[model samples]
Target: MSTVTSEIPAVEATQFQHTPYYCEENVYLLCKTLCENGVADATGSDLFVVFISNEKKQVPLWHQKASTRADGIVLWDYHVICVQRKKESDAEPLVWDLDSTLPFPSPLASYVNETIQPSFQLFAEYQRYFRIVHAPLFFKHFASDRRHMKEPDGSWIAQPPPYQPIVSQDGILHNLSEYNAMSGADSLSTMDPDTVGAAVSQKLGVVVSHTQLEELFTKLP
Candidate 1:
C-alpha cells in the first residue's frame, strides 16, 4: 500500500465550507477554493471533479456520514467529489469527499477500497459509473440552477447553500444534467489511458465504470 508522507502538504478538508446534501455545489466551491489557494498553480497537481452515479441514478457508497445504516452505506441518486492527481511519481492521487466519513483527503486507493468497493457485486441497477471533468474546464463550464433540489411543486428537497447558484464562466446556466448523465455506452474501460484522458480534457467529461475509477485518475498525465 502507498502512504502520504508528512513531507507532502495537503489542504485541510475542513478549511472549505460544506452544506448538507449539496455535494455538487460543495465540490464546485472546493475547486474554486483550490484555485484561489493556488494549489494547482504551485504543485502542477491536476484537479478533477468526479460525479458518481449510473443510468438509474443510483449509487451505493460506504463510509458516508449520512447513511442511516450501521454499515455506513448510503444509496444516493448521485454524488460529487474532487480528485487531485499529484505530479510526484511516488505520491498517490487523493480524493476529497466532504460527505464521506473516511479520512479527509483520503488516498485514492483507500477511498476506492472502502467507499466504492468495486469488488462487491451488485444488481445491474446499483452499478456505479463515474463522470470525470478536468477541474479547470469544470470550473469554467459548470453551472447549476438548483432545480434538482426542488420538488415538482417547487418545494425544497433540502436547504440550499447560502450563496447564489453557480453560473458558468461562459454565462451558461444549469448544465448539471450534462455532467451527471452517464449512459452505458460512455464507459471507457476498453480504451487506453491516453484516450480516457483526452476525452475528459477535451470534452465536457467522460464516464467510466467503478472499476476504472482509480486507473483513470492514477494514469492521467
Candidate 2:
C-alpha cells in the first residue's frame, strides 16, 4: 500500500453539498465542479467515475455513513464515487466518496482497505464488481432519468435530487442502466492492457473485480 503523505493538501469535503442517497448524481456534480474549478487540469489528475455493484445488485461496503450498524457497513444495490489519478508517479490516487465517513478524499489504498475490503471473503452473490468510466467521456455520455428510484406504481423509493435530471451532451435521455450493469465475466484481468483505455473510453466503461480495482487507474495510460 502507498503511504498517505502531507505533500498533497486535502480538499475540504464540506466545500460541496451532496444530496443524501443520490451517489451517482453527487459524483456527477463533483466531476463537473472540479472541472469548472480547474482542479483536474491544474493538478494533472484524471478523474474517473466508479460504480460499485454486481450481477445480483447486492454489493457490501464498509465505512459508509448511511449504515445503521456499528460497523458502518451497508448493503447497497449500487454505489458511485469519483477517483482522481494524479499524473505524478509518487502521488497516490484519491477517492472522493461524499457518502463516506472517511476523509473527504481518501487515498485509494485506504478506501480499498477500509471501505472495499477486498481481502474479506464473501458469498458469490455479494462479491463486488466495479465499473470504471473515464470522467470526461462519462460527463459527455452519461444521463439519468431517475427511473431507478421509483416504484413500479410510480411512487418514489427515495426523494429525488432538486436539480433536473442530467442529460447527455448528445441528447441521450437515459443510459443509467448501461453504466450500472455489471457482469461477473467482465474482469479487467481478462483484457489486454493496451486496449483497456480505448475500451473504457469508447464504450460505457470496463467492469473489474474487487481485486483488480486499485491497480486499474495505475495500469491505464
Candidate 3:
C-alpha cells in the first residue's frame, strides 16, 4: 500500500455562521475532497463545493427558498472548491482543477450593467480562496459574539469593532478600492485597521479582550 504523504483539514461545524444552506453544505463537502485529492470531475473530484453569495441582482430562482420567507436568497459573498482530474502521465495520476460554481441562475443571463459589476467583482475575489492552500491571505469578515465580551465596568457595547484581514492564505494583498468594491463597503478611512487589532478594538470597544486578535496579527505579512 502507498503511504499517504500529507493529511488534510476537515470542515469544522463552526466555520459556518448560519444553518448550512444546501449550497453551503455541498461546498463544504467539496472543499474536503479538493483538500485531500486535488481536482477531478463531478463524479471523481474531491473538493468542497465552495459557495459565494452572488452580490449582484436578486438571488437565483433555483437557489431561492421554496416555502418559507426564509431569506430566500441565492447570491452570497462567494464559494469555491478544487477538483481532481486524471491525466495520462508517467508519474502522478491526478492533477488539480478549480471549478467555480456560481449560485447565480443561468450564470450567463444578461442583467443590468450596474447591478452586475459588484457580483463579478465578488466572483473574482472568491478565486483567491485557492491561495489558502499554498499561502495565507488576509481576508477578514467579522461577526461579534457579544455574549463573550464584557466591559471591565460591567456595561455592554451595542456593536463590535470592524473586522480586520489577517494573512493566512497566499495571494496579492487587496487594495482599499478592491476591498470597498467587492464588499460594496463605504470608505473605511475612519474605521478599518491598518493593523487587525485596531479594527477589532474599533468594533469591540477599548475594554474587550483581543487575545485572539493579537495572535493573528503576529503572523501578518
TM agreement with the true structure for every prediction? 0.91, 0.91, 0.23
Each prediction's Cα lDDT score? 0.82, 0.82, 0.26
Task: Mark the 10 consecutive residues where model 1 has the least summed lDDT.
Answer: 1-10
**Number of backbone clashes in candidate 1:** 0
Q: What is candidate 1's lDDT per residue for 19-128, written digit by digit as tens? A: 99889999988877877787654322378889898889889999998998887999999999988876665677778899988888888899999998878989988898
What's the C-alpha lDDT at position 133 in model 1?
85
Which portions of model 2 show Cα errors greater than 4 Å? Answer: 1-4, 42-45
True lDDT of residue 80, candidate 1? 96
What does the lDDT come to for candidate 3? 0.26
TM-score of 3: 0.23
Writing each residue's lDDT as its tens digit, candidate 3 over 71-161 gives 3334433332222212232222221112212221111122112122324433332321111111001122211233323477767533333
Poorly placed runs, candidate 1 (over 4 Å) = 1-3, 7-11, 42-45
What's the candidate order when arranged by decreasing TM-score? 2, 1, 3
Error of 2 at 74 (Å): 0.1
Model 2, residue 80: distance off in Å is 0.4
Winning model by TM-score: 2
